[model samples]
Structures are given as C-alpha cells and as structure tokens.
Target: MESLTIRRPDDWHLHLRDGDMLRAVAPESRDMGRAIVMPNLVPPVVTHDDARAYRERIVAAGFARPLMTLYLTEGTNPDDVVSAHAAGTITAVKLYPAGATTNSASGVRSIEAVRAVLAAMEAAGVPLCLHGEVTDREIDIFDREARFLDDVLTPLRAAHPELKLTLEHVTTSEAVDWVRAHPGVGATITVQHLLANRNDMLAGGLRPHFYCLPILKRGRHQEALRAAATSGESAFFLGTDSAPHPTHAKEATCCAAGCFTAPIALACYAHVFEEEDALDRLESFASLNGPAHYGLPPNADTVTLTRGAALDLPPRIDTHGQSVTLFDPGHPLHWHIH
Candidate 1:
C-alpha cells in the first residue's frame, strides 16, 4: 500500500524541556495531536501551579493541547496531586526512581516513601507513569529494568492495586510479559528501541545518541518489544521518550541518555508496524489504545501515511544554541505522514 490513513495519534510519553529547548522541540510534536508531557525539568513540575505554568509555556511554543504530568518525588504532596488531577491541569504523576535518568535527582528513593502520594493519586483516579528502572549500584546497568520489575514494581502494584500504572518506554521482554498479563495496566514503547538494540550503542564505538535510560537491550529483547508493540495489545502503545540533550552534553566525557525522535516519530512507528506485517493494527496501537487507557477519546481527525518512497529525515535539529540529533533507524523508511 502506498498510503494509509489512521486516527491522529497521541504520544503517551514525551519530553519537551523548558526554555529554548521547549520552544525548539514542542513544535515537532504538533502533529501528534496530544502528548503526555514529562515533568523532569531542572526543578521539575511538582504541583498543579507548576504544571499550569509549564502548560502555558507549551501553548506559547505552539503545542495545541499538551497533557501535563507532575514529577513524583518523595516530598510530593498528596493533596497537590489530587488537586492537579481534579483541576485537569495534569493527566498523571511520573515516578522516577532517584537518579534513574536526566533531571531525576528529586525522584523517589523508595516506594514506601511516596505511599501517601500514591494513595492520593489512586483515590483521585490519576495514573502513575513510571521510569521502570532501578539505580541499585549492585545491578548491572542493562539489568536494572528487569530487576526493577522484580524488586520494586511487583510490590508496588501489589500494594496499590487501585492505582492506574503505565510503565513508560519499556525496553525489556520481561516488561512486555508482565504488562501483557496484567489487564488495565499499560506501557509505552519508543520508536528508537523498536529500531535499534544495545549493539547500536557499543557495537562499533560509543554512539552516545543511542544511549538512553533502561538502555536498549539485545536482539531477543528488541524482538519482544517489536512483537508487543505491533501485537495490537491495548497494554502497549506509543511513547517516544524523545529526550533531547545539547550536542555537547550528548557527545561529552559522560553522555546523557536520551534519543530525540519527535521530528519523525510517526514515520518510525509506521515503518515498525509495516515491517512486522501488522500495518492493519497500527491505528489501534498508535491512536486508539493510548486514549482508552487514559480514559480519553481517540482523536476525531486522521493522519495519512504514504509508503513506497523513502522519507529523508534530517540527521539533526537545531534548537536554540544547542543542536539535538535525530534518531537514525539505520534503514530506509518508506513511510511519510501527510
């Protein structure tokens, strides 16, 4: 098929940083209709008022409707979360195990420490979006996610059965299995992980841009993620986790972890689904499932994607004084959204 049309999709997870970075990247996601904006800023968005201000900035940057999330820290006030959700200023509360990723110094150090906030979110019908990785020094970096599933996530879920949970940018087969087995729980998959693996990072030399938290796994894990993403499972949907770092930050002595792909996210998804021979299921995965999980309606408009011709995406995006590199899928992408 040369062309395909589907409901306009929402990015279940995205990161448009503050200031010039936000201004530069927010516009790239305009076609995504809506996005659950991550709250891992410098100070982080931790309250209803903070989210409101951030939302205003996003609107100022030309993002039509950006869904907000509050960073879940140990000190996060339960009442604040309830108020934010009730007021509709934020859609969810994001949990980042301290030091899990960029701008996460204030993330929760222990699940027990944030029980009050979690309880409040549960009572308020607010979803909990997780980074899904652990920072235990004993655990190998690549093994953090699977270990987190066993060590933290399992117990957290058991304790808060009522809390709606979404494992964001899940990168392991173990995550796919657990999410699939649990009904009502959801997860988001990034296009970068769908196209690349750990080899892409270390196979030749260090490819810093390919490095991301819950670092990309091996081939089997990649296959599992691919299957879970294209299987048309409601538990799995789209989350670009399109984190951007300055060119210097990404190419430094110790590089920050993230892949900026907001510019070509849809095309990447189309390529993944089409390669899996599940093009018919793309709409459900990209558009319908996310809104259903979020208790929102799918977008009324549609986006048409054309295949049979390669779309030449720019290798990098200039955002203010810094430049962010775009993810290279390492294959010809024959799909383009129109």
Candidate 2:
C-alpha cells in the first residue's frame, strides 16, 4: 500500500518549553488532535491557575488543544489536583522523580509524601503520567528504569491499584512486559525509542540528539518496543516526548536529555510502522488506544500518510538566535503525513 488514512492522532506526552521556544515548536504538532503538554517549565505548573494560564499560552502559540498537566511536587495539594482535573483545566498530573530529567529538580522526592494526593487522584479518575526512573547515584544509567519497576512502581502500583497510570516514554523489555501484565496501565513509546537504540547513541560517538531520559535501552528493548507498538495492543500508544533544547546546550559537556521529535513525529512513526510490516495497525497505536485509555472518544478528523519519496524536512527550528535540532532517524523516511 502506498497511502494510508486513519483518525488524527494524539500525543500522550509532549514537551513544548515556554516562551519563544514554545512558539517555535508548537506548530510542529498541529497535525495532532491533542497533546498532553508537560508542565516542567520554570516554577512549574503546580496548581489549577498555573495549568489554566499555561494552556492559554500554549493555545496562543498555535497548539489549540493542549491537554495541560501539573508537575507533581511533594508540596502539591490534593484538593488543588482534584479541582484542576474536575474543572477541566488539566488532563493529568506528571510525576517526575527529583532530578530525573530536565527541569525536574522540584519533582517528588518521597512518594509516600504524595500518598494523599495520589489517593485523591485515584478517587477522582485523574491519570498520572510517570517519568519512571530512579535517581539513586548507584544504579547504572541503563538499569534505572528496570530498577524503578521493582523498587518503586511495584509497591506504588499495589498501593494505588485504582489509579489511572500511563508510563511515559517507556524504554525497556521489562517495562513492556510489566505494562502487558497489568490490565489498565498504558505506555507511550517515542519516535527515538522506536527508530534508534542505545547503540545509535553510543556506538561510534555519542549522538546527543538521541540522548534522552530513561535513556534509550539496548537493541533487544527496541525490538520489544517495536513489537508492542505494532501488535495492535490496547495498552501501548504514541507519545513523542518531543522535547527541544537549543543546539548549544545539546552539544555541551553535559548535554540536556531530550529529542526534538515534534517536527517530524508522525512521519517517523509511519516509518517505524512500515518497517515492522504493521502499517495496517498504525491507527490502533497512534490514534485508537490512547483515547481509549484516557476514557475519551477517538478524534473526528483524519490524517493520511502518503508513502513515496524521501521527505526533505528542515534540520532544525530557529528559536530566537539558537536552533533546536530535529531528530534524524539516520535513514530516508518515505512516508509524508498530510
């Protein structure tokens, strides 16, 4: 098949940094029906008022239906979280372990401290998106995610059995199996994870563009992600985790962790689905499953990916004088989304 059409997709996780960078990258996601906007901005969106205002700014930046989230903090008020979700000011609450990723210094340090908040969210039906990794200095970088499963998430899951959870940008074979074993948990797989493995980042020299938190795992993990995403599974869906960092920061001694996948997200996902011989099941991963997990109806609109000829997309997007690099899959992408 040369062309395929399906319901417009939604991004289960996305990061559009505030201000000029937000304006520069927001339009890149216009083809998506909605995006669960990360709230890790400076000062972070911790309250209903904060999420509402951030949503307004995102709308002004051209992302019309940004589903805003609150950056969960140890000081987070349970009442504030329930109210925000009930009022429709926020879609979910993001749990970023302290120092887990970029701008996550204020993340929850003790999950026990947030137990009341989690209970409130569970009582109300608010989804909690997790950056599932432990920050202990001893755990090897590659083993953090798997360790998080046994050490942190398992007990948390057992305690909050009724809570809605979406494991954001999951990158391990263990994580894939864990999500499958759990009945209602959802997982978001990114373009970088599907298209490249840890080898792509560390093989010859570090390809900083592929460096991201819950850093890309081994090739076997990539194969697991590919199989899970293309298997028409209900628990896995697309969330680009499309984080952008200025070129200077990315090329620095301590480069920031994220891939600016927003600009070419759909095409890259199409490329993966095509390679897996699962183009027919693309709609289930990209469009159907996420909404079902979030308890929403599928979008009314549609997008078509016409497969032919390599796309000549821009290498970077200019924000002020700095440029944010776009992720290159290191291969010719034949699918162009329209």
**Residue-pair clashes per candidate:** 0, 0
Clashes of 1: 0
Give the residue spans of candidate 2 off by over 4 A: none
lDDT digits (tens) for residues 1-338 of candidate 2 = 79999999999999999998988899989879999999999989999999989999999989999998999999999999999999989889999999999999999889999999999999999999999999999889999999999998999999999999999999999999999999999999999999999889999898999899989989999999999999999999999999999988998999999999887889989988888999999999999999999999999999989989898988888865658999989998888888
Compared with the true structure, model 2 gives a TM-score of 0.99
Evaluated at residue 327, the lDDT of candidate 2 is: 90
Per-prediction TM-score, please?
A: 0.98, 0.99
Q: How far off is residue 21 in model 1, in Å?
A: 0.8
Residues forming the 10-long window of minimal summed lDDT in candidate 1: 313-322
User: Pairs clashing in candidate 2?
Assistant: none
- CA shift of 122, model 1, Å: 1.0
Task: Please report how far candidate 1 places residue 164 from its true position, in Å.
Answer: 0.3
Identify the candidate with maximal TM-score. 2
Error of 1 at 227 (Å): 0.6
